[model samples]
Target: MRYKNLIFDADHTLINYTADERDALKRIFEEIGLKFSDKMLDRCCYLSEFTWTETGLYDVKNERIQREYHNLYKTHLDLLFTRIFTEFPCSFSPIRAGELLLKYLKDGTNSISHAEETIKKLKTEKGYNIYIATNGLIDIQVGRLKRFAPYLDGLFISEELKEIKPNPLFFKKILERLNCTVKECLMIGDSLLSDIAGADGVGMDSCWFNPKSKENQSGTKPRYEIKDLTDLLQIL
Candidate 1:
């Protein structure tokens, strides 16, 4: 095998985050006594993505800028309800709504297709050290990834590291903690901006998990690309 360590992104790579988000959103609406509809969910998703993009969450070019934007975005949780419930005539405060959303999101445990089986095979048969490197909230991610605990060697979360992906420091910290060289590891993820670019920035090999065959408009490229988790067996 060319790589000894396999670093995976949580959302979309190994977990069905979209499904989790949709389910959590519906539950939150119900808890808050608000009617939920698919259109409302779509609007919320759109606004959330737009907000993250506009806040430089995906495009920060340097560690300094990344850190600054990350800190500023923390308050986004408090304002999320304001952005999504503008026309809903809700009485719940943004802070309360944010709390409810996080509560439900933390309970979500949806996994991607073949995620556990592939991870198990890689760990047991291939003898690779598997770890999850995610930029998601620590509490939510921890709860969501409970099913993969037996297979994972460790988890590197941005909240705990005080750094986000695309920043060299984030990947460097993981390498330092793992006591491994960059060349010995392979980063596998769905995001071109975060996972691929971050690994590339740190001189590490990367495999883009593009299940949807999304167009790659970003300049940062991965060393390999796969459309499925099982494909990792052949590449590794």
Candidate 2:
């Protein structure tokens, strides 16, 4: 095998984050005394993605402009509530709403197809060092990975590490921590922009798990592309 250390992405790579997040959003809205609808969910997702993208575009590493994630998360919740109130008939107390939503999100769980089997096969048969490299809230990603942590050698979350993906520093930090070279590690994930691009930036090989068959608009190419997690067996 060319790769010894396989750095797998958590969400959408080994776990179905979309399913968990949607379910959590619905449950959170209901618990907050608001009606949940697919449209509302879509809006919430859009706003959240937009906010994160815009924030990411800035030089977040700069000390003068660097902001705490808690503050950003609070702003996200506030924006979500304001949008919900404006477009839909909803009422809720703002007190502790962010924390309540975070609880629901953190507790939600969903595993991707063949995730456990693939990990076991790679570790046992291929003698590969499997580690999770994910970008998201520490508590939420950690909660989601609890069941799979026993199968992994290590787990790295962006919030705890303070280094978001698509940035070369994130990959560099992971390599430094593992004491591995870029040529020896493989990045497997679903996102073209973050997973593929980040790995490419650091001269590491990447495999894009396109379960949905989404077009690669970002022009970032992965060394391997597989439609299913099980397909990884053939590659490895």
Candidate 3:
């Protein structure tokens, strides 16, 4: 085999998260007596991506830094809801509104096409060690991967490890855990920053799973590119 270990990103890489995210955002806003608009959804997405990007910058090495990380995350969420209500003229309190949206996002996820089957073939038939290297809330990533848990050899989550990808340390830790070298592994994910860049940092081969054929402007390049999940079967 070309690679013995396969690291996959859980969200857009293996799951169709856009529809679920939009519906969840809409439902949360509606339940709070606010009119859900595409603009609101777009704003939510912008805020969330910014918050996550800021949160991922902190690499906690001690208890104090870890506490600061949590504080930073809470502060970001606080500002997110405040901006939401301020910009949209909602009557609801930001705290409660934020909680409702968080609850929905944590509990909902939908798998992408051929994700389960492709994983099964890789793990069962191909005999490759498969793990999910994802950055998200522990409970949320767990909720999404629970059904695939038995098939997966391991999961490296940002919330639990206090580490996010695009950082070489995240990939280093995963490589250590898997007892594999960078040459022996391949990263498959949608994000250039978190997946491809991080893998590049650690000298690991990466495959960009661009299902939408999105243009790559991030400058970080992948060793391979595939539009469909099942395209992995042929590559391996």
Q: Which tens-of-lDDT digit does each residue in 1-236 have in candidate 1?
A: 89989999999999987788788888888887899788988988777677666666666565555667546455565656787778677888877887777778788878888899999999999999999999867877898889999999999998899888878999999999999899999999999988998899999999999999999998987999999999998888
Better of 2 and 3 by TM-score: 2
Worst 10 residues of 1 by lDDT: 69-78
Best by TM-score: 1
Ranking by lDDT: 1, 3, 2
Error of 3 at 103 (Å): 1.9
Best by lDDT: 1
TM-score ranking, best first = 1, 2, 3
- Model 2 weakest 10-residue run by lDDT: 57-66
lDDT of 2 by residue, 1-236 (tens): 89989989987788876677677778877776777678878887776667555544333444432335435655666666566566766666443555666777777678898999899889988899999998777887788888777678999888777777777888999999999899999999988877898899999999999988988887788999999988989989
Candidate 3 Cα lDDT to native: 0.79
Worst 10 residues of 3 by lDDT: 57-66
RMSD of each: 1.8, 3.1, 3.8
